[model samples]
Target: MAELAHIIPASTNGPRATEGADLTESERADPTNILVLCPTCHTMIDKGYSQYPAGELRRWKERSRRARAVAFGTPQFTSRAEARAAVEPLLGANRTVFQLYGPLDDVFDDTRADQWGRHVVDTVIPNNRTLLQLLQSNRDLLTDGEKATVDIFAIHMKQLEERHLEGNWTPGSMRFPDAMNVILKGDG
Candidate 1:
């Protein structure tokens, strides 16, 4: 599991605690100063602070941020058609996975349930996140209704992530917005 590791140790009472002594309190608490590392990596970095200095850790964080931006960044599209083109592939992928292994009535068997869980984690969740990013970034192409649909979709996405990633099951979470299918298409 991923653990939040402070780039410059959060506390000053334990191992490598003194590492962030130079940073202000706000900087120490900042998201930029945290690394989402696996438990083993977190332990290694915490125990070997000299080997993983604050500057080096900060560089790693920055590199990761840049890499994610390149991999998932949405480009500006001039028209609704262009935005639709950019969004369709991810939507199709998500639909395919949902059709094959989603929590449908016919897929209630144990094996299918297992596959559904795995696909939700490995495919559905990531696709939804990327789709959300694309829609939000290309909001200029959306109609008023599409924007409203997106706001609801955002809630569904958050609950889905929390249910799967954070293991926080919330009842009565909003369903996927069907209107999202035509987002940035036709009229509002």
Candidate 2:
């Protein structure tokens, strides 16, 4: 009787320079941990010579999804200084900007960045989620004025992202305080 064969990465038949070829010990055949690969494409795929992995594109797609969830959330801080530090680094060369860093060092999606910034400003920061936790946990270390300033800064950052998403890309237009003032004065 012929046993059913399963697909996997196997020892290279022809003479290629693999250091740990068939001399390796056998792994306990755990169905859960086995990775399947095509023998002909093994060298090409393993050496990063091809754009696509031959059989499984789903794993690559899954990695991106999980990475986005980690990158697109509001940052938490242990102190007001820490909170400011996180945002301060984001304050770019005259333009307010934030970077989303993920597992693979992927760049932030602009639309997702817009949503994340707004979420932090409108819901998280204003509600004293990140800042208050920082303050209370640090023995009420943040002065009222510092908290107020951060609140204002957070709101400003939110407005900037909102304007950016809405296509108001003129200089100083994406600025948080300036944009808010314009709205208050009915200019934009």
Candidate 3:
């Protein structure tokens, strides 16, 4: 179901061949140097149609390895609680964003509104971006149920950024509290 292509090409005449030269043939063939992609994606990459270059491909492969480790690595959890506890830190990063969300006032002038604008712009949005990366980069760590939760949160964060966080958002028009309640409270 997966196509394993060399991160550094097996052919010595290829672009990254020198880099792989130091590696033994077996090392060059090692799973670490390989990328598992769908057949169509594999063809695109192999045919040099992908936008990603060698370095980017390598980084993606490394992240995949890390994700796989998260899914299957040592210090195995003995219970659902233990597994949830392990990923709590990743999910908790959004706590400040949730706290700041409710204080946003779209139709009133108040200190909370001021705080909301500053906090959402200066902190929440940036934190959400990082949280997205954390969730995506370590996706394999979560169970199917947990992955669903994380994915929904990510979608909400992206939507919030696009809707209210980007650019000079009008003060009386951005009702983040109502708009992002689903994300903030995980109610949906």
Measured against the true structure, the TM-scores of the candidates, in listed sequence, are: 0.59, 0.25, 0.40
Model 3, span 49-94: residue lDDT tens = 3455677889887677756866765333334444444444534545
Model 2 over residues 39-72: C-alpha lDDT tens digits? 6544454555235432343364344454553387
The regions of model 2 sitting more than 4 angstroms off are 1-88, 92-141, 168-188
lDDT of 1 by residue, 1-188 (tens): 79998886666654455766677778877988789999999999878777887778888987777567657775655678877887898888888887887777554588877887888899989989888887898898788788889899999989988888898876787878888777766644
Report how far off residue 58 is in candidate 1 (Å): 37
Q: Which candidate would rank higher by lDDT, 1 or 3?
A: 1
* Candidate 3 off by > 4 Å: 1-93, 104-109, 167-188
Please report the candidate that would top TM-score against the real structure. 1
The candidates, ranked best first by lDDT, are 1, 3, 2
Candidate 1 TM-score, true structure as reference: 0.59
Give all candidates' CA lDDT scores.
0.80, 0.40, 0.60
- Higher TM-score: candidate 1 or 2? 1
Error of 3 at 180 (Å): 13
User: What CA RMSD would you report for each candidate?
Assistant: 12.8, 17.0, 13.7
